[model samples]
Target: MSNKIAILLATYNGEYHLREQLQSILYQTHSDWHLFIRDDGSTDGTLDIIKDYASRIANITIVDNAGEYTGSAAGNFFKLLHFSDYEGFDYISLSDQDDVWAPNKLQAALAYLSLDRAGGYSSNLISYDNAMMRTSYIDKSQAQKNFDYFFQGGSAGCTYVFTREACLLIQRKTVNITTYKGRSHDWLIYAICRANDIPWVLDRQAYIFYRQHANNVWGAKSAFSGLVSKFKILRSGWYRDNVIWVAENSGADVKGVEVFERVKRNKLVDKFYLLTIVSQLRRSKRECNLLVLILLFLF
Candidate 1:
């Protein structure tokens, strides 16, 4: 039997591009899939559009939200995963309400996962700005460094596909969590798999058209703008907080850096000590240098 995939789609006020994204999913080459959608208190026509699709499609399911608003895309996705019968599915994929998936996206992901014997899969994306009519390839498939998952996600969550075993591990890790600590879901998932020694494949192929818009929670930015944004986030101490949270919660046997414990205390000496091992923290040299600067000044 062909692999049956459960696609978890999270939506907010995404009425504008929701139809196009839904249409793209309907045209996928891999047809053995079920779509489970959950809305995070959308006050717009997003719910109506989802209802229309569910009305016509037998395999599409609208997960009941119980009138509780998650208030964030990551939270809504976590709720979707918690409520969906994912254990019954052979594989699981995540979807955003505004991205257009390639026709062969699922088929290609499944092929890579099977061939590599991997537990999780993610790929690069083609980020498109509709208003500007500009497109750029976003490459997130850099070589994995020692603790890269602790710093960033492998790729966009919309491009993520996980084996049943991977899903089980995620569910177990997040079972007792009441709050997500403002961390991206994709980062947490990648961290979980990596911490458990699960082989995760990062495909160089682009499988989704990641939409960039004014309301995007984490949209693409220009190089300079991205640097400025990172600076602002670092200045606010959010990065340090998240790193400590992941270290504590990700189940990794936090080794090597004996100063990790002191760094968690926000000590100045330990922060300086971390600057020496920045290469192990991030994947790219540019990012590693930036991380060192952040530790030296911002931390």
Candidate 2:
């Protein structure tokens, strides 16, 4: 059988740039992929654009969505999965409405994930570097270096790819996460990888462009706004909250199964090894005393 890939395009009133994006995919070096287009209630002519292409593109599957925003990114993506039955796709990639995918995006991301998940046992994530199309940015060398640098802070999700195993784990393992509305999608996805001891690797920014616009719900923010935005960005350690929240919001019964399995199999020598945490925290205060003094002085 031919290798299959599915690009889940979750869109809302994106007629402005929809056709161009579809064409970019068609121009890909690898064309053995399906396009799952979800119109999250487009008032624009987005559905029309999809329809125009569907007649010519055999692999396009469209999901009709209403304009009432889902209140959260998790809700939006979960809604897409529910519509697609999470079936018939080998590699699942997250697609945005207004972005441009460089021809080698799929080839590059798959190469990294293929190596990182060599055993093909569990979930994995692959992300890329993106230029802000219609805006000023750097050159090729800068983009390449920035891919790893940007990915180390996790992902911004314009071109994040997931394996079927990743989807299944979300379906099977992370049923009862407690993620909040208007929270971070990329952060929670990364945290889930961490929680289940699943492996993840950066794909070194496979030539993607994140299109910025005025009506964007997510992506493209120009500095924090007011106290609230500042607080949200400044709350540096809130990643834990995102983890717990995703489980709770999932509304599934994952108890005594997945997370438990992850904890049980953790290596004894791991930094937060269960046997050592109690002792480490106790010793931390004493050992970190000098470090704390230096930190305080430097600040």
Q: Best TM-score goes to which candidate?
A: 1
lDDT of 1: 0.85
Write down the TM-score of every candidate: 0.94, 0.65
Model 1 segments beyond 4 Å from truth?
253-262
For candidate 2, what is the lDDT? Answer: 0.53
Against the unseen true structure, what C-alpha lDDT does each candidate score? 0.85, 0.53
Model 2, residue 162: what's the lDDT? 73
Model 1 lDDT-worst window of ten: 251-260
- Candidate 1's clash total is 0
Tens digits of per-residue lDDT for model 2, 1-299: 24467777777778888887888888878777988876656678887889888888888877666555565555566566555445666777777777777887777777766766721111122222243333433122121121111112245565567777676765554344433365765555544453454556654344676666666665545544434553454365343333335444332114323332323343434213422332211122432353233223321
Q: Write the per-residue lDDT of candidate 1 for residues 1-299, one digit (tens) a residue.
A: 35899999999999999999999999999999999999989989999999999999999999999998878888898898888557568999999999999999999999999999899999999999978788999888878887787677889999999988788878888888787636788988888898888999999999899999888888797678877987788889988777666656667536423644756766777776677677877877887887787777887
Judge candidate 1 at residue 182 and give its lDDT: 68
